[model samples]
Target: MQINQQIVLVTGGARGLGAAITTTLVHAGAKVVVNYFKSHALAEQLQQQFPDQIFIYQTDVTDKIEVEQMFNAAKQHFGQAITSIINNALVDFKFNGEDRPKLTNLQWSEIQTQLDGAVHACLNTLQAGLPDMQAQHFGRIVNIGTNLVQNPVVPYHDYTAAKAALLAFTRTTAHELGEYGITVNMLSGGLLQTTDASHATPQVVFDLIASSTPLKKVVSPAEFADTVLFFLSPWSRVVTGQNLIVDGGLVKG
Candidate 1:
């Protein structure tokens, strides 16, 4: 299905990359359900911009019950099953490598939180949204990931480990769901130029990354979000179980 005919649920779709995805999809005429954990005001503001096209809802995607409720509400609001989902919600984390705890100091709880955000969040949404997708015989699932799995420049052990698990989940889900006309894939990116999560990163690091990239620039959230459109569009009907890195050729693999 094309974007206009799809109703998309974007977890954490109020700020940063989530906001960019919401804007991009809405502009393309997709009905969007913007899920936010705490960005009530920002979500409301985004809804105001495209009140008719966007449905702003507050829900913690990690909580199975809340996710179910959000899915039901989205279906009721749109009078149709959500045709796509962007698993973009992540637990609060900053990209300041210097401030991050050393491997010896990192706690299991830290790893658990990332797993909750990365893996568990995806699980809850898949379970809640799959029935509809099966009924319609069409669905698109795009899981947001990080290039740190391949190029762990900072070695965010907990975060990278969790994302690696998400990668596995993406492929496994694709294998299981493709028979039902659903496509599951991942879009991994490098340190975004600027986002709430990366604001703590020093400007020097950003400049260094930009200089190293073939594009000579750090990728913006909007630019990365634009690629999401292709995955959700009909052109990707046969594409699944792939991880497409969007880091401006910093890592060719």
Candidate 2:
């Protein structure tokens, strides 16, 4: 389906990278359901910018019941099943690596929290959305990931491990759902220039990354957001179960 014809549901679509993706979709004429856990004001503000194209819903994605309610509301608002989903939510996370718990100090609960955000939340949405996608024989699923899985320079143990598990989920789901005409993919990016999550990152870290990448600058949330368009577009119908790194040549693989 063309972008303009799509009905997309973006989790955590109130601010930062999620907001960027929501804005891009609205501009492309797609009807979007912007789901947020908190950020009600920001979500409302985003809806104000394009009231007709954006519908805002408040729900914690990690909760199965909340996710179901969000999807039901989205379908009712759009009068159609969501044709695309961008799992852009970063539940309970910050990018201040310097303050991250040392390996010996990290708790299992911390890793579990990341897993709940990355894997469990995604599972809830996928299952909730699968029926409609199977009925229509069309769907696009994009899971946001990090380059740290490949190059764990900062070693965000819990975050990286959770995303790695998500990548595994992405490919396996794509393989299983391919016969039904659904495509699942991942977009992995390096430290984004600045997002609510990344804002705590030291400026020196950003500069160090920029100096190492071929682009000679940090990638912006908008840049990462734009890449999401391809996965949703019909042009990517045959592309599935793949991770596309969007870190401006920071990780070639």
Candidate 3:
């Protein structure tokens, strides 16, 4: 699981949390494929920054054809031997001035989109990447999850349910891929500061959560990126199918 000289693809990697993860992996000496749905400018900026080690692919994870094309393009650019994948793409949310979902008025189409964006994307990546990973006898798959699935303090019904399904998929994949030296795990976190996704949270809500945490602060994208790097590193080879919470002590086991 050494990241050096490895090929890793990160979905939704143009900006926000995904950007941090992509940068972290690139710094670790892994060749990175930065996937984005619409952030063309950011994707180009990242490619410019890591000219030799990074490449960009515009992909909508919810679209199976687009996802397939993305992987194909990455293989064509970096060869057909990718070693790792980080399933971190998600559809944009319309938070409606609150942290919780309006269950009674939530749109079914919106919910379906979130589920497809999260769960289906992971499934598609596995379907596309497994052949090569199994052949190479080494692979690392990390699915990003949310601490809300544990606490449900802010019931983002669609988001939490989708992530929960993703966690389940991670475990099942780990079990099936273990014999081949492929590891699959999840990293769940509470509100992460400085990400577009978290910008919707009211200042008061963030303050309250920070005060409640034993650490008294929200996690930075870099901190979360560090955990992801560890899971991708050889150190986590023995670990698989477990959801590791990184919520600054907000959700106790």
Candidate 4:
């Protein structure tokens, strides 16, 4: 799928990384549908920014029915099939290492919730969009992940474990979906300098990360979002089942 012509669906596209991806893709000439569970104001704000190219659908992406409904509505609104998706929706989480529960105190329910948000949500969106992608012979699926899965600098155990599982899904789906010209991949980023989720992070932490990285700065949501366009572009037609970490070379794959 060429990005400029891609009919894209972005989960949790109302704010943070999702919002950046949605807007960047829109500016590149792709019509974007944002699947938002909340933040109606944020969703509406995007509408004003790209009134003709942005569409908002309220959906819990873990629900198969709701995901399918969003897909159908997007096609109806855009007058074409959605050719790509960026699974960036997240359950409530923060990067506070100090307050995070230790392994001994962590509950199974905590782990389960992260799984639902990271793994199952990807499953729902993929199932809903795969048929259309197969019919069209092109698809680009990018799951937003975290650097913690690889480096674990902060030990967000539940979050990292869930993303690791999501990577497994990315690879397996890429293997199976290859025959249909569909590519599945992941983009893992470190503590983004600024996001609604990362707003709680202290400046000292950001400075420490910046000084540690080769680029001398923490990754920004917009910077990571730009990489998404690459996966959707025809340039990556031959690539799939890969994990690309975009943390200013803090961790190499």
lDDT of each: 0.95, 0.93, 0.86, 0.91
What is candidate 2's lDDT per residue for 143-236, written digit by digit as tens? 9999999999988999999999999999999999999999999999999989999999999999999999898999999999999999999889
The best-first sequence of candidates by TM-score reads 1, 2, 4, 3
Total residue pair clashes for candidate 1: 0
RMSD of 2: 0.7
> Per-residue lDDT of 1-253 in model 3, one digit per residue for the tens?
5798689989999888999999999889999999988899999999999999998998878777887887788888987567899999878864334645588888888778888988998988888888888898999999999988889887788888889889888899899999999999999988888688887777887788889999999889888898998888878889999999998999975
Off by over 4 Å in 3: 94-100
Candidate 3 clash pair list:
none
* Top candidate (lDDT): 1
In model 4, the Cα lDDT at residue 95 comes to: 76
Which regions of candidate 4 deviate over 4 angstroms? none
Identify the superior model by lDDT, candidate 3 or candidate 4. Answer: 4
Show where candidate 2 strays beyond 4 Å.
Answer: none
List the candidates' TM-scores in order. 0.99, 0.99, 0.95, 0.98
* Candidate 2 least-lDDT 10 residues: 93-102
Error of 1 at 234 (Å): 0.8
**Ten residues in a row with the worst lDDT in model 3?**
92-101
Q: Show the colliding residue pairs in model 4.
A: none
